[model samples]
Target: MLQAKAYFDTHHHVGVIDQRIFSGFLEHLGRAVYEGVYDPESPLSDEQGFRRDVLEALRAMRMPLVRYPGGNFVSCYDWTDGIGPREQRPVRVDYAWKSRETNQFGTDEFMAWCQETGIAPMMAVNLGTGTPKEASALLEYCNLPGGTYWADRRIQNGHEQPYDVRLWCLGNEMDGDWQAGHVPAEVYAQRAKAAAIIMKGLDASIETVACGSSGRGMSTYLHWDRTVLEYCWENIDYISAHRYSENRRGDSAWFLAEGVEIDRVVEDYAALLNYVRGVKRSQKRVYLSFDEWNVWYKNMEMDGKGESAPHLLEEVYNLEDALVCAQYLSSFIRHADVVKVACLAQIVNVIAPLLTKRDGLLVQSIYYPIVSFAQHARGLSLVPALECPTYKAGERGDVAALDAAMSYDEASGTVAAFLVNREQRQEMRVVLSLGDQRFCEVLSVEVLGGGDAKAANTWEEPKRVTPRSAEAHVNEAGELIVTVPAPGLAVVRARVSKR
Candidate 1:
């Protein structure tokens, strides 16, 4: 049997534990904008053109914030095209997603949608085709006290009050060659610094994120982060990172261990944050924003048609992706101190865990782990010690035999354990030690299990991949043992009556 432990120590429970790590993204490319969030004619859409079913699903996740406007779309995006009137708005080509972007749902519409769905908006500006002046105007339009030109324009467009959005991204992946207007690291750092100064000048309360490398494997990953942070370290509050994964090789064992990749990236980025902090000689520590991440590249085909106007980045997730999501959630909670914000690449049909049809929506396999952690996992991250043996893939070398992250939520009086079992045909017995704490009850046990790797949920039979619960007990010394099946993700919560 392998042992893993999480302890509740008051000293370990630190400052404000933000649930914003449970945030999401909404880009203009796919059904994410058109059919997913903003279809006026859908049977399930509300009066505001927001999908009622999708809103309910997102409300259930209890999302704290959602990044808006673009993924790659924001790179060359012109925010002005979507603002004033629906009738006069341009039908522009979206080169990034290979679709036509109707400027109907711009800043005003998105803010309204966020208000209706009860999710805060974290806006990313259009540095790809925009200037510091243009970015400043947007900041004034959404956040300034309604008096300036942009502010008056927003008011004239039906918003009488300020949106007062406090979070901003200076640019989206300006250092990546794949981005629409990729800039050299030096040029990007300079522009990002200037933009941060202007955006903050518009609203001092706003926190800004400067661009880092697109992902861990970028040739300029470390250098770009270092160079950008060196220039904007004192100006911005966070540095952004984006990554999309797919089982290109489809090697189940190796693919299941992909969560380790997200972690290694985050942990290394955390180190970069520290390096910048030391160089600046400041105690005002800056954190990281993993603004975009998901199991994408599955639906993007090389020879596929440009399809049509909302070339929906639709991906039907599988059981394996769920296991990967669970392990990645563990990584987020494990490093909660540094990674203050994260968005699950998207919230709807565009490679998201929540899939939607015209009338109804279904939760994908990955949804279970993300929702479970967002609902129950909070508090200071505790170092979880695991004594599981190791596994190896064809050249990937010793991956974690078992993947998990443990944290104690003092307010809820529960110790949450999120774990993933990636081993094929092997049920590993995991002994969870609660570390000398008395429990009140077993609050919950949520697990996503399937008979095969390709298991998914469908509109006709949506509950095929939802989480199911089971009962477990702790002994007098505070230990609960269970066997984790292959390709399964589990979250166990034990309550304490004393707290």
Candidate 2:
């Protein structure tokens, strides 16, 4: 087996890992909101029309937060349209996805679903066709106590208590022309500034996320972000980032090196945030909300055809995609200080980890890594110094064959390390060097890997590419040893104490 070395000290930590970083997203687009999560007609659904099996799977993943109501769908969405009686609700044309929205599952339904599933809701307002006043009104409806117009409306609607959603997005991808109301950076920043000011004024405790550049591929990427931050610096708490990696070239090494690309994106955004803060000389810091991110190039075609809950962007993730997903989690942990919140875009049937049918749920290959990381990778993120061989990843330059991140929970004396081997055909044996704190015993070692890179899971064969138990131990020399399969990822957790 190939050999690698990694060194870590409990003292040299990155930051406290925010549990929200292991979050998921749900959009009104495709089947994500309809048959995916909310289905009144399914036998698997609860009384509120939420899919019981889907909620169970999500709970198993340990997702703490879920971004709701939109992706591009919210750009033109009217929250009020979905609020009142279902019989009176109007069915509008969803301009973003070219589908029809029945408004059957609206704000109250979503909040109820979130409450039952134990996930915090992160909402996005419509800035495309909506006004700042409208944005503030929605905030008031969700967060304010009674006696006001919107709050009283909420009361009349049967909810006396406020939803009190803390995290709000000004808009979704306002810089993209494909969006419902794509505008110039100056215009978006102006609108965002107004919205944030009023929204915060309404609640004063809510944290707002200003829209940054849609993606690095945009011509106005950094420029748009700079303008927005320079405008909404004090009002907003975090800048929203959206990223989706594609295996366009069919190069496994380059595809697996997506983590390096993710690192670059985070670093670039962090630098931009710092620059804006310096320019404003502001004491208040803005972190990143990587709200929409995942491997999404597989199913780009949207075949909505005016249908409700069409199978749009329903990507069947392969083993390589799962490895890429692991890399994403590892990178998020490595940059836990800067990237405080991340949502795996669209949690069900829309380029998601869990695919839902009327009868059953299909857990994708990417689901295992997410579950592993979310379950064990918690508490303080530890910085690991690694010595590993490198492979050329095209424009990404020389990329390490081994990618890794570590987290230690002081309260539980638990240390969990997530490792990925990018080599296509060789297993790598890694020796972990712990300084001062020696691992006492191995808790569990699980590997998500298979011989075929393109292996995926389907309803017919749900466990086709699932994770299996692996071997790892604390050696007599006070080191930890584990062998990770090629083109695979592993999560090794152990009990630890000071030497």
Candidate 3:
């Protein structure tokens, strides 16, 4: 076994764990909305047309917030087209994904879905082909009480009360040329500033997110973020960053180590945010919204094929993907202070954790780590100092063999640790030392690994890659000695007693 030591001190705190950090994303693209979450034709659907099974899955995950409507789809989406009578809704051509938008699910429907599932809505407006006035109208419709045109229109459409959506995104990836109505950084910054001002002026309580860069690989990554912040830092509360990891080279080690890239992405953006804050000499701090992220490389050819193309971008995740996702969540916990919110790109079907057939659904391997962290990892984030072995990879050289983060809930006297063993063949012997804190008993230990790294949960074998209970114990010295399997992820919980 590979040896490692982890030190956790209550004094060495990062920040309070934001529940929104574990949030998910839902877009209009692919089967995410049509067959995945809203399958009115299926027996699994409820009276409202929302799939009961999907709702159950989402509820089980304890997702706190969900970003609504569009990834690229939002760039050309007209919110009004989705509201009012479904029969009268127009079938517009969605240039973003080259699909025909049936306009069945709109702003009202998404808000209603969020209400039904008890998740907060993070609404994104169409800055690509939309104006500040249109964005403000959306705010009025969602947040304002009846009596005004848009507010009363919302009432006439059936919802009597306001949705009171607090989080808003000014645009979706405005910095990318691939995005519809894509603008240069300076141009996008000005437009975002105007939209932010207008929307906030309409509803001061609503928090707005300015589009940063699409990803770190963009030609203008941090520069785009800096320019947007320079122009709209005070107006916007958060800046949006999106990333999608891929195993295109078929390198398992490189694939599992993608979390290192995610960590660097957060660090770079956070550093930029801090630098901009200092330069402006502004007391108002702008945090990061890693609102869109996931592993998306499997079905690239099927995307952008227009209305004829169905089942677009549905990725079948394997054991390695799950490990990478777990490491991503661990990275979020490590930077809880700067990364205030993160949406797992999507929640269902389209490169998502949950996949659906016509009448049934299969929970992907990535879903295990999500629910594990969401349910167990809460409260204060502890900055754990780790002494672990390292390996030399291609790009991310000298990467640690083990990636881990810990959280302590003082009220419940519970401490939860999330660990990922990145090594392909070596199980890690991890000795966890909590300074002056005694864990009386090991509460639970769930490990998500052991099978083939490429093995995935199929409809026939849904339970094939599920997490299993692991052996964990508290020694006489009150430290945790746990064996983390190679190429796996583990969540360990313990009852911490007052020393």
Candidate 4:
């Protein structure tokens, strides 16, 4: 039998886990807005036209924050076009996704959804075809008290109180050639700096994020980041990073090793952030916001046809994809000190975890792991020392068969360990060591994966790929022993005491 050991020390910790790390994103592309979150025509929708089923799922995820308006859709978007009465709202062509965007669900609508869900808004402005003044005015409209022009306009739009949104993204992927109004790094840096100044001047409490590279695959990846930081490091509070993984190569082992890629990318960017701080010798520190990330290579074609709520980029996640998503949450927890915020590229329909149908929705396989970590992995991040067997995964080199991260909640004295077994056909015996801490009780041991790697949750079989409770016990040595299945993600929760 394959064997491994995971050692955890309650005293050694990374940092307080940011609940925003489990945050999600919602863009205007596809049915994420119209049909997914705001389906007025559906019988399941509430009085406000928001889908009750979708809101219930999102609320259960317990996401502290959610990014809104656009992934690429905000580039050519005008905030004013989305406010005021829906009858008077204009329908415009979305240049990014090549779809029709009705201004019906604008700033007020998004704010209403956020309020309903109790999730804070991470607003992104239009820096692509928009100017710095426009960015500041949008900030004024959302955050300022109703004495000014934009604030008064917001009040006239039926929202009397300010939105008071704290987190602001300057733009989306400014360095990507695919982005609307894409510009050189230097030009983007200057524009971002000016916008940051104006927005911050309007509301000194709000935090701003400068666009970093779209992904590490871009030719301008780190170079773009360096130039932007070199120019606007002082003005920005955080830099953004977007990444998406796929199994297009048909290599399962290499695909499962994506956690390696996520870890290295975060480390590299965190180092770059530190380097910039040193170069400028500034007291102000900027962290990373992995604002856009998910598995998104399967549905590369856009079938929108310039219509409303068209299907586009709706990638159905499978068992293998669930393991990767778990690894994503694990990596974010591991680097809690540097990576402060991360939004799972989308929340529903458009390359998301929950798939919505006109009648109902299917909770994809990826949703299990995401919810597991979001709900259980809280408090301090405990460093887990692992001695596990490794396999050579193509270009990723010697990848560990076991990927894991542990967290401890001091108030409850509970220790939750998130583990992923990467081997395809071999179940591994894992001995979880708590060192001198005494294991009090086993709360739960839930495992996901072990069936077909390509198995997914469809509308016909919604519960086809769900997690199952596994048996776990502690030995006389006080070490927890559990058998993690091949190609599986497991969450082991227990109460520990240091008597």
Candidate 5:
């Protein structure tokens, strides 16, 4: 039997959990916007053309924020074309996705949607193919409370009040050559610094995020991060990082272990930020915005095909993908200090947890972990010391079979632990020790596993692979014992009385 031990202390706090870390992203890619989230033609849509089914699905996840209007789509996008009446909104060729851009859904539509769903809007300004003046103008349009040109335009357009969006992205992946108007680190940094200065100048309350390397695999990687931070450090409040996991090699073990890679990325980026802070000798600190992340690899076939194909990037997630997603959330919880905000890239149809059809939607396997963590993993993050059995994976050698993260709620005295068992066959028995804290009772225990790694949900069968309640109990010695199945994710909540 595989064995693991976890120790959690209330005083050893990692960071205050940011609710925005449980955010989602919606882009104008594939069916994410037109058909997935806002389908006026569909019978299931609301009067305003918002898909009611999709809205309900998103509401269930309790997403705190939703990033809008782009991914690669923002790089070449003209924000002005998307505003005003739907019929008057111009249509352009989206060079990034090779699709026709219908500007029907713009900033106004997004704000309306956020209001309907009770989610905050995190907008991204177009840096590529757009000017800093335009970026500042867009900021003024959304934030300034009427009086100025853009602000008055917004008021005249329909919304009398401003959006007052707090979080803003400078650009999307400026380091990638494939991105429209992609520039070198120095050039992008200068542009971002200018935009940050202009937007913050317009409204001192808004926070800015400068684009870092697209992923760790980028040729520049940390160097891009360093250069961007060095140039735009004071102007920017957060630096952005984007990552996507895949199982191209068909190795389940290795694919699941890839979750640890995210942790490593966060650590390295945090270290880089620390080094930059020291080099600058500045008192201000910068946090990370993991604004775009998901499992995306199966749908690259139709990329660059242009308007001829509209639905090219819808990826169906599997059981293993869900496990990996849990690990990703666990990593975010573990590094809450540095990672203040994260948006699950494209939250509706394009590589998203909730997939939508014309009539309704399907909750993918990855959706359960997202719901669980978003609902329960709140309050202060705890640094849990863990001892577990090890396994040797191909490239990610000597990996821990079990990975765990814990959160403590002082007001309610609730302790929630998220555990993942990476082993393929063995059922690991876990012993959790809460030092100097008396265990009251197990509030809830849910495990997401049992199906094949490739198991997934379809339109016909939406509940094929989901989480189920597990058996957990607190022993006489104040230790909680639970068995974690292989290739599984478990979330446990218990009431604790402080001694």
Candidate 6:
């Protein structure tokens, strides 16, 4: 069933649009940082020893900013151990990844890799097993100009210059039991507040992300936000949120419902931010950094396997998962109004869109929508409200509908519409009407689909599930009716003439 809704407004200047929302993340969990992005022996390596193939992929996507060196791994990590000589560097157990942590690819390697990939670093501190003093030392090591002690030691380690990284995370996931030095909400709040203060005291130029509950479903979610903000309301520039959808329901309805839940997480955070701002009676707005997000379920059981065997976080993705990924990315752009920054969990090899091997990296089928959105959807994120058509997916709990977003770029004189259809076997002929103005023509249409909802891509056949163009056009009524395929994601670009 194809349904339609139309509305428009001009003055919705909601939030500061941070280009970092297009940013990706690189953690030391899987091959994401080590053999994934940097392998010295690879023939495709650049001068800095970063993989050229991976660099080219990132460059093509133009992922301008990224978070580095730890997800949960940041908790127990000692920044000092990995800074100096390669031989003297220690190899310890990575409780997070359950692998032997070789100090070979520490801060310096990451900074170099960031340079090669052309991404700014958003580093996270070790609040789990380390102290505020240790956090300050790392800031000095990375951002301070060449000087005595930390800066000089960075010089002695063969890198005479400072990295000058401007963004930092206070801690990884302080409220979660899985984190190494996990503490109570109040304890984490006090520690995160103190860390933000000192971290700011050390480098006022950098922006800090204070830890909120790891996700909305966490036991300490609400209290964690309130307590953390009580101490960090002023020092921190942004509050962080992390979430991943695990589809145990194994049906379209479950997937659909969980998808809405992810957006609800963002909605909840915005509300929390508003509440705190009112309580403090402060004018400063605390933005959100969704530094961790993606469709992850590959390593669920690996957690019980033990830390030394840190579950290899590699997730072999399929067609359904990729569609879910596209839907999530669309949600990010749609809500980019409040979400200043979002890191798509680990961007490569480890629970990611693009997979890498020794020979070269393969662009997953899911990578297209992300690339199109990231490159094209940079202009005004106009608030596009929709009366989404509903259906009873076996995830929506009887909520049947469509998920969509639109961006009108003034410079390009174009309107880009991203839409996803959740119901099985139903094509949506949505009348995309311009509520206030007129669009001359719908110039391009990119559609991603599958013969069956469960179809996917594999190593033997990479194109098993990919999007294809369909019958779509605009009518004289100035309404755009495009066929949105079942379980498909569509991007329509149009050029507007005049009133």
Where does candidate 4 stray beyond 4 Å?
none
Candidate 6 residue-wise lDDT, 1-499, digit = tens: 5665534332342433456777888887757776678777788887666888888888866776788777888998998878777898888877786777777788998888887777888998988998888998899888777765788888887877789888889888888898999988788777777887887887788888988788877888868888888778888888888888777667755675556877788888878889989989999888888888888885654342333323366776666676677666666766776688888877888887777777777777667667777766656666766777667766356664677777776666777788777766777777787766677877888888734766656777777766677656778876777877776777888886545
Which stretches of model 2 miss by more than 4 angstroms?
none
lDDT of 5 by residue, 1-499 (tens): 7999998888888878988889999988888888887888899999999999888878988889999887888999889998988899887888888888878888898899999999999999889989899999999999999888999999999899899999999989999998999999999999999999989999999999999999999898999999999999899999999999999998888887976899999999999999999999999999999998889888874464556227777888888899888988999999989999999987888888877778878889888999999989889999989899888777888898888999998899998999999888888899999887967799999998864888899988888898898889988888899988787888999999976
lDDT of each: 0.79, 0.90, 0.89, 0.91, 0.89, 0.76
Prediction 3 global C-alpha lDDT: 0.89
Error of 2 at 445 (Å): 0.7
Better of 3 and 6 by lDDT: 3
Off-target runs (Cα >4 Å) in candidate 3 are 302-304
- In order, how many clashes per candidate? 0, 0, 1, 0, 1, 12
lDDT of 2 by residue, 1-499 (tens): 7799989999999889998899988899899999989998999998888999999999988888898888899998999998988999999999999899999998889999999999989999999888899999999999998999999999999999999999998999999999988999999999999999888888888998989888999897889999999988988999989899999888877898898888889999989989989999989999999998999887887858899888789998999999998888888899888998999997999999988879888999989999999999878999989999988777778989899999999999989999999888888999988797998899999998847888898877888898999999888878899999888888899998899
Clashing pairs in 4: none
Q: What is the model-wide C-alpha lDDT for candidate 5?
A: 0.89
On lDDT, who's better, 1 or 5? 5
TM-score of each: 0.94, 0.98, 0.98, 0.98, 0.98, 0.93
What is the overall TM-score of model 4 with all chains considered together? 0.98
lDDT of 1 at 348: 87
Which prediction has the highest lDDT against the true structure? 4
Would you list the clashing residue pairs of candidate 1?
Answer: none
TM-score, predicted candidate 6 vs. hidden true structure: 0.93
- Models, CA RMSD each: 2.2, 1.1, 1.2, 1.1, 1.2, 2.4
